[model samples]
Target: MSANDPGHINDLSKDQEESLKNFWISIIDKITNKNKISLEDFYDSTYGNELFNLFASDNPDVVLLRRLRARKWNVNLALEQLINTLEWRFQWGVNQLVAKGESELSYQEILTGKTFYIGYDRFGRPINYISVKNHIKGQFPSETTEKLTVLSMEIGRKLLHCPVESVTLIFDMTEFSMKNMDYQHTYFLFNLLQNYYPESLGLALIVNAPWIFNRCWYIIKRWLDPVVENKVHFINNIDELTKFIDLSNIPKHLNGNKPDFNYIPPTEQDNIMLSAFQNDFSGNKKARENHQQASINYLRITYQWAQTNHNKDLLEQRKKAMEQLRDAYEQLIPYITTRTHYHRYGLIEEPIFYKTYQRIQQENQQESVHF
Candidate 1:
């Protein structure tokens, strides 16, 4: 790489850096309506209201950067895509669904264990296991399956940290047959990730894919963008998979050390947080108000950060604001959300369960950044 090439030395190219600044400036102008709109109103509108509150506390810089990179650093296209995503989240009730927790889907849908997250990859990316044989077309509502898929992706998102913004996917095709094929579901997953959550798939392992699946893959590859299709790998055996993920992280069935997936149903006790909130409405109301204030403050700082040119002091302020926003969100979690299997099984911790992978890495004292 040339020393003069900023892209090689920094996270963003000079042109991309400028586009990111302009992107934020444009959104702030549009959302604030020429500085007429209040910061609180701008926060609620763009973040999709209280329904999206639980999942809305995100680092503005990271969020905007992801969209910019997805659109190849084109500000207008990225802005359009961002708007479409927000509109879709509202129209499809995705914000509400995610905020309410994964309970929105039927018990049986989750029990099937067709799709769920497990351990993290060597790169600190969460591993999402998909048992292809476990899926039977027409057995579950298409919409329900879609919801589950989205929920799983959201779970993976929480586990992610800086420099590891993607998830590792393992599609166990041990039995592989035509009966397992669902073009509709496949297309939805492919398109959804490509368009809305672009550059979010680190790797995809199609394990033990039978010969017959090769024919289907030929057709499927045509539907993928070359960049995405290249990230996919056809694993012939355990050895092939071990190359990408540690054996300790892979399941025993796949010739790895980890235990196989087993779903533990959620119980009434899992709603302990919700029950607490209901029992003490007044106290919970105060907590919610504090959270709302923190949110508004974060947005205010973010807006200011966006307008000013980059500087060490401003960046520190933005970081502190993000920490405060996260702290408020953590404190309000138990009063607002329901627990899931991830919580019950101890795979996740309540009241601020994001970034499990990062936590694990810190505990193990692993600081290397895997590529």
Candidate 2:
């Protein structure tokens, strides 16, 4: 064979090409049982085949077949089905790439005991196919809440135990719905997490809808304290949120106290004691702390009371009340800092945080690379 000859390396003759095409046709026919299948069935059975053939062929019938196949099916429907299949395959391929990347990255991070924030969707759906694929491959935290809580706890544990100072708790709130939001639905939902764990360094609540941000604020503020209000944040887009997260001094604020339970801070000691006694600790430590702190920090808050001549005994009572106020903090501090009481009361088991973190990180990386 000449050095430049194309025939040198197992080049197929015309007859062989014809025979191979016949063989493939026979295989396809056998697969379809030689049945006269409808265009829908053809597209369904052999996805994008007709389309591919039409693109490759000079025959008019192939183009006609595509149009005929698309008649009963709306453009969107046909397009959607084809796109779904393509997307699925693309996702699968992307997932494989992610798996390799994650194995390398996760192994390194785990070995080094490094803390990294992995963002996840609300359902703990893999943010990327690779994470999803690896999760499916490794069978990590199967349930959504379990996965998220486990992720949270893993990061929390790492922060608590390792040299890592903090962890990023990233979540996209685009699909979050207050109407469908349930506290106990999953083992590690957002609200349940707020109740169960301390607020992390910061939270990235990705809100594409402005109204959703308001709703999320309500749900989060229900459990977190005013101090940690800065920790909870809202962003209109992922890019904005990510940028803000990097800046580290993004502005955040409380949703403001509810009007129904609104009360002015007590000015006198007697009032503070009465307020403390009547204060509701219905939610978690964060809520209770907000109430307690609001009461103590603003001891001079004015409230309407029947004006009466000041009495000496009443003044002493106020002094005693002030003493009681000082004592309450000593008691409340431990309660707030100790293990969350609700966590023991049928709160879901500790979630698999590290696996979730790894899964999310892999997913995000896959998405960035693929889509």
Candidate 3:
């Protein structure tokens, strides 16, 4: 490829690359009912197609290419994997899953407690820990485990803001018991990560794997595909995990030098507003009203502060303040917009998000250029 060329050199054989490309092209054609690429064409496709569009490196060809690489490019196997994953998404409602949050699920918070974003690895990948024994007990341990695994994966990918990181999942089977182990759920979780969320797993550290873990691992081992197998690491000691994770970033629970998992209450005004929103959403009308007032007051304060303190000397600080103000104002706009959920207090006004998005874009451009 020439220096000016945009695409990267493919590691695949010419025939194989073309085959994958053809597969992608055929699928795109089927989805759009058209041969060509266009804005509307990509948009018309549903979640399955959207995954392709979002993941495509300049084109749809790479979407299948990654899947092919993940599955060793066995055409029949790749096609099966792709179709199965899309089917899973349809059944699971992958998009709507995170949008509703953990409130809908009774076992969510307990499940969430089991998984924590401890810190980042040496290569800057986010390190997430899952205490397998913590929330393994429920009416159906398998279902609970699966939901928590998916939630952890989703939160790691979307909410955590690790721009250049694939999350490292440390399955801490400390103080383990035979009953805590669910081979079916373990296999399903591994398969889910392998198929749908391809290559998001930088590492899988299995620490403190007691003798009982062997029984489950015997079954689980067979289920892991080659890609997943490569990522999996069985650590005898938790301290061994410190090689990837920095000392300070490591939580005290893991026997690291850093502080314990001190729950940092939402310090930002926006975050506080979100807490109030949750309270309001959970049938507390007063909480909703309070959130609205707080948000409005925040916006006004930031605006007045910016207007009065027009000191060119504090350009950077002013920009940060403006960004905060813009965000706070956006939050206020969405508060009283409309009513949606039977449980939640206010309506889901998407326009606030769109407006915030526009402001963010403008702010980004403004920030890029030195004032």
Candidate 4:
């Protein structure tokens, strides 16, 4: 569809998203059923399924399914969008986009705490704060918004040790004005967050929005589906935000002085889910550092006589092994995105997948299960 498609946002129905769940169980089954070699076996197992092999997992299947939901379970459309984003990542070499520290030079320019990820809330959801006035129009690079947003999310995932799958965005529009509100950038950001990155934003608390923001948001809200529109809220100040997220995780710069509680975990959330992402960040970073040297050693290897000679079959086996190693070393962003889009995919009843999803559907029956 063209940019001018009027029903672009609403064309995909919410019901469609809720009906496609086990493809998820199938995904998990696919990962676990690989040959008993090692953790490296996961990639080869993934490749066995043609539907999955079409694109590499820059992020986990949880996030991949979100894109699918965004397109109402239309796998082809969702895959196309996913591939476009992946192609962008490959071209930019953004797969290596690591936030070294809060002060890391790579992304520090965007980490002025203006649109920065502070920490996780009580529910283990990452809480991001965006100071609109600090955002000077045309000041940063063209991809500044995109890069900063993605980095914030990646860093958020690293910081969150719990099984939280989504993020809570705080748009602090304290000094909001036409001058500070970059219309072009705002338009671009909306499309990126809504169309490109879906099922990731859990809540959007728009605080201190000026009259102009409300006017603009009014028009924008009309285009949004109710599921998204309902998440957007207008708040007066920081005090109001405390209801959804505890004040402890809020930054000191944002009038959050007492950092006593870590958003006091919900009474019912004592036994929170813990996703694999919590432990993978540091290991992934270290792997990237030595990855080049490792590649050199591989290239310098002397092959067997059969492979070196005219044996096509032997050479092909060698090539497959090489690809598996390369793929194994490549890092993918660990994710357990929002479970609201979960569906049973009632078509197939493969026993293993059915059992896994049966537990999942039960866990997520009453509410959206984290991770």
TM-scores of all predicted structures:
0.85, 0.25, 0.61, 0.53
Error of 4 at 93 (Å): 3.9
Candidate 3 ranges with C-alpha deviation above 4 Å: 1-20, 33-42, 45-64, 74-76, 139-145, 159-165, 259-371
lDDT of 1 at 236: 90
Give a tens-digit lDDT track for model 3, residues 1-371. 11112222234565564555455544544444543544344433464344432332122234455466566666667766776766676677654554444533444344345666655677666777777776555545565456656766665643223234356888888788876676666667777777887656778889888887787787887887776788888887656877777778666767777654333322354344444444344333443344334333432343343344244645454445445434443454333222222113111224553454354446658869966
> lDDT score of model 4?
0.50
The 10-residue segment with the lowest total lDDT in model 3:
338-347
Q: Against the true structure, candidate 2 has what lDDT? A: 0.32
Give all candidate RMSDs, comma-separated. Answer: 8.8, 32.8, 14.4, 16.8
Tens-place lDDT per residue, model 1, 1-371, is 11122332136666776787788777766667743777776655644353235244555556667677678778999888777776666677766666577768978878778988778888777899999998999999999999998777767766675556678889999887899999999999998788767767879989999899988998899999887898899899777788889999998878899888888776764554355445655555776777777777766676676677777777787778778877777766655555667777666655443342234335446535431
Q: Which is better, 3 or 4, measured by TM-score?
A: 3
Query: lDDT tens string, model 2, 81-195?
Result: 4344334434433223321222212332222211123222232211110111112212222243233333434324322311222234444333444543333432234433333
When sorted by lDDT, best at the front, the candidate numbers are: 1, 3, 4, 2
lDDT of each: 0.72, 0.32, 0.54, 0.50
Which residue runs of candidate 1 sit more than 4 Å off their true CA positions?
1-10, 34-36, 46-57, 351-371
For model 4, give the 10-residue run with minimal summed lDDT.
338-347
* Residue ranges of candidate 4 with Cα displaced over 4 Å: 1-59, 99-108, 160-162, 222-225, 258-371
lDDT of 3 at 303: 33
